[model samples]
Target chain A: MRWIRETGPVVGAITLALGVGAIVTALTGYSVPQVFRHLAVGAFGDWYRLAQTLTQATPIIFTSLSFLIAFRAGLFNIGAEGQLYMGAFFAAWAGFSFQLPPVLHPIVCLLFGAAAGAVWGFIPGWLRAKRGANEFVTTMMLSYVAINFTSWLVAPGGPFHGTAWANQTVRIATSAQFPRLLRGAQLSWGLIVGVLVAFLVWYLLFRTPRGYELRAVGQNPLAAEYGGINVTRNMILALTLAGALAGMGGAAETLGTHRRFIELFSPGYGWDGIAGGLIARAHPLGAILAAVMMGALRAGGQAVDRAGVAPADLAAVIQGLVILFVVAPELIRYFRRLVRRKKLGDIEL
Target chain B: MEILSFNLFISALRLATPIALVALGETYSERAGVINVGVEGMALAGALTTAVVAYFTGWPWLALIAAIGVGALLGALHAVWSVYLRADHVVSGAAINLLVLGFALFLTRVIWGWRGTSPSAPTMNAWILVGVGLFLIGLSQVYIFRTPWGLRLRVVGEHPRAADTAGINVYRTRLAYTVLNGALCGLAGAFLFNNLGRFTDGMVGGRGFIGIAAMVVGNYRPLPALAAAYLFGFVDALQMRLQDYIPSQFSLMLPYFLTVIVLAGFLGKAQVPKALGKPYVKEQG
Candidate 1:
């Protein structure tokens, strides 16, 4: 029964996505079946494509988990985008600045990224917990600050500047890169890390005392205080952890794929993670699945464009439709049942 | 120095006008107990609609009207989902943003055969619109404070159940204010496309978000919101003016940095509408 309830929304969402694909195909003058086939082929037809999809999905998993962790503690950490960028900047800095042994180098860079992200996350968390500030507005403002700060840091004549084609930082050392898990594809060890983090998050939320306290505080801080939970401490810890996860995602994208820190590397992945977390209702495993679906749409949308059927914007349409359908499954089901009943009456009468 | 000062003032006012309009729009929604996170998407849809209509018809006024109508329609969709259906207002707003973005992108590609819409637009005199926009802002401030409807709206925002007992139609008031909010945002978008003589993909780039920050810093009051918007515009103008002296990127970051500082400073003391993000469900006896 629990499984049925969970699958209900998922099935509704898939149906909605399919309906949208059909509409897009008709509008764009392409065959619906062919477009679907092309998307499948482009995303998972072969080993290479599957690897690409996994790689694309990896960073999102981390960021989505980050969002989940904070949300579980009743914190809306909208600064994840800024945190991710800052983490990437720090990781890139550490990667290029030092020449440590291969194993230690990557570890150090990852830690550096995590630390940078945590600091960024901690600011809003501290302000909100201590002064009763609204986290949403503060975090949103921080995102712009982070983006501009990073851009300035990487521009020519800045500290992190390299041989610049545009305003960007230098590439990291070869040893600093996350080791590739497969040859001829971009899949790296980051996917394993992302999966491990998801399991760890699940454990932390469900099996740990700290998690209980955080959840309690989230449910009702006043009551949690009566229960002897330190609400302020939990709030700060949750935001810091959330920031670390998002930062790691940023580091993974840089080390595994781009190999360099660039301005605007994220096409709003942090915001996408927020959407993914909300869709999953802050469940760890659910977030992983939701992130993958988002990643698939993005990865496959590229193929949809190449198939001479639709443009990249079609993917956005499908995404919006999926979210709408998921949130209001009853409406879709009701309409479908209405249509079916009408058809049945026509046949019998 | 004289040339630079003249250009800075113009650019500042130009940048400030749109943000001021959007923030003022949000002021009403927040006061009426709805958080309008779809401002970015609303602006995008409005700008795109204005560009397309103005391009074919070559009538700036009609295009402006179309933009406002479409924005209100989008707001209606938001109201139906968040207010009537009782969905999470923030999530509903996010869904609307994604929907509008997707729809705008699709329609732009289909109608213009261009990846992004960039139509040749006729220029409307900025001074006229700016003056009118400012006047409206002042009127909204006065109307929101001095009128019975304004008092009712505030009562609804602060405590919907109490307002309901007092015979205020909470849902209807919220719906009306949200629609009006959408119109103001649409006007801002029109200013971007027509006043600027052209529109780009990033024309309203993060101004919607900045407008939200302005509202927060302003404590949701109309005059203070305008002041915050002007402060942001001043920084933005300064950045452009000092582009020669400072690194352009750092200069560009000035407004955002100020947003962080201002938010941090004012957030602690800001008094939000008590029932701001809460939905009011009528009790069954």
Candidate 2:
């Protein structure tokens, strides 16, 4: 019941905002009704679109879960982007460099990718926990280093370079590809893995002793310290787990979707995870749902591009609005209340 | 050899000016206890606005003012979200980045009808702009450390509760300094546009992040921040000059790589403002 009340206003506001956006578009010379109709059809008009949205949602789920975990432990983990890239790079390396049985290959590649992301995440987490450095700056800086390093690896004369100047790596072996869960659709076993991970995260955070300690530290590190929990170790562990999840997201995207490591493959999924985690209020299930909505918006917006209407930059606009509205609901509520009170005053007169 | 060194020094100075200006701008906001992580977004907005305004108006100075105004608008939005609404500063900052990026992309497509926008340069060259930047840097150091307002801002950062007890309005001070910071950051962006003669999407690149690094490396002192900026500038200039010797990719990444190493090594001991990133809520005694 409490959850219903909390989410109710968000849903209402989003619907109203969408309507307003449509009206604005109509007034400004685009057919808003047609655009929305097309978007609905394009996104869920068929099974293919549904599968594509689901497939896109899969990586977002992992990354958003990663963000939720770190945030729960009071760590920012801005390096998730870098960690994801590292995971992709490692997954690609494992997939392309090795010859293994089809049944075992994808699993091996994913684990390697997870390990790489964990290592990437661990650098800043350990630094913050042990040395008391600011995680925000360290993690953000690491992102650049990771991006550059990945670019360097795929450049000519680098270890993972493709045989051309096109700035991409060789395609992975067929064995390393994630098996399709649905025929004729891009949906893969990765979606199941992502859902399972979300449940595991929910269970770990809500039903475990370590989860209690992590939350305690997040709420008040000093209190947790006084309660005898190893705060630094927990911080490091939280970041490691978070990075592993994000790394798996990168791995899933590569092995399940692209099958090759390309420079700048991500359209800022890690940053999107930040927004997703915040929107979901760091709940595992909520993060999954928000990730899907975001994925849908991205896919639907791309579909709308085909229908003209300038594509609308709706994803970014909605993302910004959601954060603004969620964080400052009082602004909307106060205004509404003021209007109501003024109307009442006028009626009394 | 002397001329070579002189040219190197000039190049380093040119690179350092924008970073130093942005860092100094950030100093005011941070001193007033607000971490202006939107510096990147603000600078980007300022750069794009300045480029467009300068291109049409044929007046570089007016363009600078427009950039400052745009930056202040962005700062106001951040202040409302982070300070007034008491949202997470980092989250608000990230949203601002996304908003600016989206807006810039949309405006570019609508106005320029191209995927990218590049404006022609005015009369003032990079060297003249570098001179102006140096002058601004000197002025900022004096104004930030020496003024009464500066002292109050610093107090707000160091001990907001005490400052409040001393009858200072922490919120107002933060608002004022954030606007000031935005203007200075705008100036930095304007320099990039009017001086460099063209605008690229990645023009600001990671310089805004580098400015944050410089702030930390300098221990939040203005002169030291300038020195740190110059140090980074030297590395950047050196990378450009040595691109033939070193792989350009490695060169391009040099500053960021060094930042990670330096931050990992030294930032453990760096003491930030006590009230940084914490919204000030006046406590009733």
Q: Pick the candidate with the highest lDDT.
A: 1
Task: Specify the poorest-scoring 10-residue window by lDDT in model 2 chain A.
Answer: A311-320
lDDT of 2 by residue, A152-250 (tens): 899887777885967779999999999887788878888888889899999999999999988888989999999999999999999898889999999
lDDT of 2 by residue, B1-285 (tens): 332477898788889978888788877788788887778878888888887887788787788889899888888877777777677777777667766766565556555655446646453465766777677778777877899877888899999989988999888888888887777777778877865786666677778778887888878778788898998888888878777776677878788777767666777666688999888887665
Residue B102 accuracy (lDDT) in model 1: 73
Report the TM-score of chain B alone for all candidates: 0.94, 0.93
Best by DockQ: 1
In order of appearance, the predictions have TM-scores of: 0.92, 0.92
Off by over 4 Å in 2: A8-35, A163-165, A181-185, A312-314, A329-349, B1-4, B116-124
lDDT of 1 by residue, B1-285 (tens): 653677777777777888898899899999999888788778877888788888888888888899898888878777767777666666677677767777777677777767666767765676666886789889988999999988998998999999999999999988988888788888888888876676666677677778888888888888889889988887877877777888877777777778767776777678899999788899887
